[model samples]
Target chain A: MVIKMNPYIEYGKKAFAKNLVYRSDYIIGVFNTVIMVFIQVAIWRAIYGSNTQINGVPFSYVATSFVLSICFAAALTANDFVLADKVLYGSITTELLKPISINLCIMADTIGNNLFKLIMQFAPAVIISGLFLGLLPPASVLMLLLCVFSLIFGFLIVYYISYIIQACSFWFTNVWSLSVIKNSVISILSGTLIPLWFLPDWLAAAIKWTPFDVIYFAPIQIYLGQMNTQEIIFTFAKQIVWVLLFAVLGMFIYKKGIKKLCIAGG
Target chain B: MRKLFEPFSFYFQHSKMLTKTRMQYKLDAFLCCIAVFVRESAGIVGVFLVLQTFNNIGGWNMQELFFLFSIIFLTYSFLVFLFSGIRDFSNIVNNGEFDKYLLRPRSVLLQIISANSDYFAAIGHGTLGLVLFIISANSIGTDWSFANILYLIITIIGGVLIQASIWLLFSCSSFFLIKTDSLKDFLYWNTRKFAGYPLSVFPGFIQKLLMFVIPFAFVNYFPAQYFLHKPDLAN
Candidate 1:
């Protein structure tokens, strides 16, 4: 069982350390969710021209939603399967026989990375977004706490989802394509490319059931008080369900995948 | 004439050899094509999303973005096709693969650059440039004076050289730092990602930093703004 720590520390450490080693490797990625915040902010600002509300989201709330989603996504971003890499490259075999679990070990690797990425990816952008486009202060203190809970569950679901995808690489030679598909799905379904708020009503309803929305959108909505008590509870429950589902699924696949792992020289 | 044609023959010869080995696996080419398509299409998807968001990016629309993309694509295509040998520099330097290049009879950079330049690689750039050209003409309405078009062409050529030099600088670092291969990933990622969007969308500081500090702006955004008659972020 993974030891329970403050996930804020757990994830914050992951983000920080990743930035240290690959500090030089600051690369661009699938605009996931925040790109829309900027794009829409520009497009909508041109549309609303200092309006109080659109689709029940005040301009301030809308701005906050975008920043929240982007920072959350970055904070949760991992090295994308360092564990599978260890397995494919024969490094996992040696590490597996070590006392630590590969899953925890890989998670540990991303601790500082998550923090680093936030600084690199989120910091400057936040400052810029705030200066040009201000965000909403939440309606109450209670909402902030709820947002925190939703975000933690959202992160657990995010990392677990990556683990599931990476774990499958044991069975497949080319997980790159699958990794691309994973992010692409996140881009469209998770509200990375566009805000879930702006998605067609039917598409938004359909995506709510999938794990992708739970990654970033769910937390942002929950935090913004856009979700009611019942909806938040349901969303949290769905996130846990996906986490349990993916974790169980990951272990089963790893069992078969380990047998398939051919350490070339060994 | 002999000196001029020697490099051409060298590229053709090695590429022929490379193709023979590559074609031996008939599906490799097809698979590579699919990967390229997915990667490019993802960018196109984002571009589509942006077009949906705004009719104008600083008074320039989708076609203007394509016009900019075309210049970058065409120049990058020619560079990657001819200078692809440099792609292996970091790897080669790390693995001590340079000894073989040194033992050969021609210039090191020239041989290395052309050693891997092949037709399929050329075609990858060809497809992107063609697509961007079509879209640029379609979106921008293609009204330009002869002088304006010529200046745009000149700037693009200069832009390609700047990008090529940066790639070379990253590769050369391997000569001193074998682990510089890690930096290659950084360079490729940042440039590809940042170059895709209009620099103005980023804040003023970023516009200045990337343009001046890294100078990646020259590759696409600066020239795009110039051609499309848009304002500079610095201004």
Candidate 2:
């Protein structure tokens, strides 16, 4: 008998090659996002001017947050989402019949997709924000490493959450609307559109316990040295917990949804 | 004698489609209204918070500034609702979808404008932007001269044209290049920022770039300054 390797490594390489071809578009995407940051900052600057404060955040902080928000949104972009699309199009039936565990395949596709975004969207947004807005203060190596690890976990959580939404298409074709609603809420709660600090108090408080913040907000803040060690530790812990929670939920939903899938041959 | 009814009938036919689209998802339509209600109301609240921090910006008191903000949002919301499909032009062109538009009997611009009319979300935030503008303007105690009102309309309509033109330009490029998702995102972010605030804060060079190159000032700032009586803004 001959042993075969997982197809994920091949899939990831193909994704990277695809990204290389469309690289200009990705750069422009980051550039436009930076432009948005400028516009947002300009608006807030017009609003704040010389004011000292609003809702407990300094005017400068608000301006800074405006810039950071764009960066974080870019960093967490979930570009690759083959599992959900595969599942919807009945491609997953073929994929599932393979010897590789369904979980590993999903993880591979997501990691490959997100890794491209991580560099193209996330890195550039940070560099641009730092250059125009303010430099992110340096932090301890330990804190930085923890932030990266936590962010990886957070990305997985985001993938799982998105997959769960995609899974709903197993039952309904009109998942786009629900997905839009989910995206808007997640973008807000994840501190992508606006930081949790600037949001309405209730909205901010409602999602505090979730891992969404840990994904973008926590890591970036850690990079900027905004959070103290204990806070960093606590946030990363929360993030890991949510990743576990979502992963479990994803497995359950996929199992249930697989039964509902109507393959033409079967 | 028979050629006169095109644009008018176009608008009417638009209203008919708008009504049906609104009816298609009654619950969604209602929820969208709620979302816009909450979002715009929060914006108004944010505007108010900013006002509290300052007595007047560039000699426009809070009420007048709010009036300006409202007008800007109103123009933006309207265009985004109606002309937003043009923003996707780049992608359409890239995919050779524009070939279909060129083949259509209707005017290309008209078809494009009507192509992706998000009537629900458009009406949602659009109505909100309009009401807020009216409330803010009325509260400001400015007597609207007939000429000033005409200028206000021109500024907004012209501003919409300017923004829509930019979108159209980008969309057309998609005929030359297919993946416009990146450009579309960039344009939206840039537009949202421009729409959200007055243009005076930036340095002269930056302002010139936005005014002459982008001409975004036509949307709200110049018009607002006219009513607010900013010293340097042109007629």
Candidate 3:
């Protein structure tokens, strides 16, 4: 019996194998994640000194938020230049000639890389840091499952947004500044740098209108049981809407960018 | 004196050429500066929001915290301006470009140091640091006497040297390891992040790590204490 293999899966495996070559990154990544978590937790501890609860939120919630957010940030390692590099280095022609979808290939590569990170870096760092710094138990098993479900959508939202930015390279030729700006905006507005609770009410409300919060904070809230059944459903729906929105936007840009693509060298 | 100054002249000539090449893409350069400024400003905004929520962290208020961050930013900008080559040494080694330096008549270290600089990062970070320094220095009410100003200058110079030496040490490791990026990120960047906050905010071991292991405490925290005179630093 003959078997057919998926090209996208092969691309994913290739990406996964590529990361294996950097063995030391796996080790240092754990320490990096731990130290980053520690720094934020220490700062938060100093902020909450001598106070068990501030504004009806306990200290453990903030600690858990940092631990989860940093871990997710570390694991959600989508390379912002994956598509841009191809376009810049004149490799996009070859990528386009391939029968497989370039977008799917990029998505597979990202998923593969993140899968390695999740198992190799994220699990260990989460376990180690969660032990050193206490973590609140998940709202429940059902909530934990739903949080993971929502997190997948969060990853898609981030990935599609990055794709849209990378697509700009056809016009600009260098998207580094745009990527930096995107990362800064995301980190600040998404509650990755500071919990949204601490943000002024106006700023927090402004953030809600954007898709940034669904990336990290929404999953966190679901895990912490901060959301009720209705709220959880609403949040998940919002996440799906963002993923679809960004995906459509990314496709539009990629189409226009490809139409105008220019390669100077053979 | 001419013999002694030869390398300095060479460095200036090399840097001048590099700056000219960088300026060819003026818009990219300007955008990069703004990108870095915005990136760094996010952290400051985070701190500001935190302080707004909680009036003070470990007895260091907003202005004092901004002053502490400004010191690190200014010193780091200088370090990047002078020693970005060392900061990116692993790439040079991995790409087999280090041999070109060895072939030169001048010192390998001098070639490495003078070969490249990141003026964009320097400008971006320097602008932020200067703005924060001006605002915080005015509000924090530092006497800014001759001695105090001189002390600040000395402290900045010391910080640049301390941080540059740390980068040099890691860059040297690239000769053997061939990839010290993650190691540098762990030892240098992560510790630098910790240094942004007051040393008293961390645990005892972290404080010790900052003081003895990396000495980043001296980079910003101790100098900040000299000016702010926080109660925690009395010991």
TM-score of chain B of each: 0.85, 0.81, 0.96
Q: Sort by DockQ, best first: what order? A: 3, 2, 1
Ranking by TM-score: 3, 2, 1
Docking class of 3: high
Ordered by lDDT, highest first, the candidates read 3, 2, 1
Most accurate candidate by lDDT: 3
Tell me the docking grade of candidate 2.
acceptable
Candidate number achieving the greatest DockQ relative to the actual structure: 3
lDDT of 3 at A75: 96
Complex DockQ, candidate 2: 0.25
Docking class of 1: incorrect
- Which regions of candidate 3 fall more than 4 Å away from where they truly are? A1-5
Q: Residue-pair clashes per candidate, as listed?
A: 23, 7, 0
Model 1 error, position B106 (Å): 2.1
* Residue B94's lDDT in candidate 1: 83
| Model 3 lDDT, residue B226, Cα | 85
What is candidate 2's lDDT per residue for A184-213, written digit by digit as tens? Answer: 556556665555665555655767866667
| DockQ of each candidate relative to the true complex | 0.16, 0.25, 0.82
Q: Give stretches of model 1 more than 4 Å off.
A: A1-59, A95-139, A200-206, B20-32, B91-103, B115-129, B143-159, B173-188, B198-203, B206-235
Worst 10 residues of 1 chain B by lDDT: B185-194
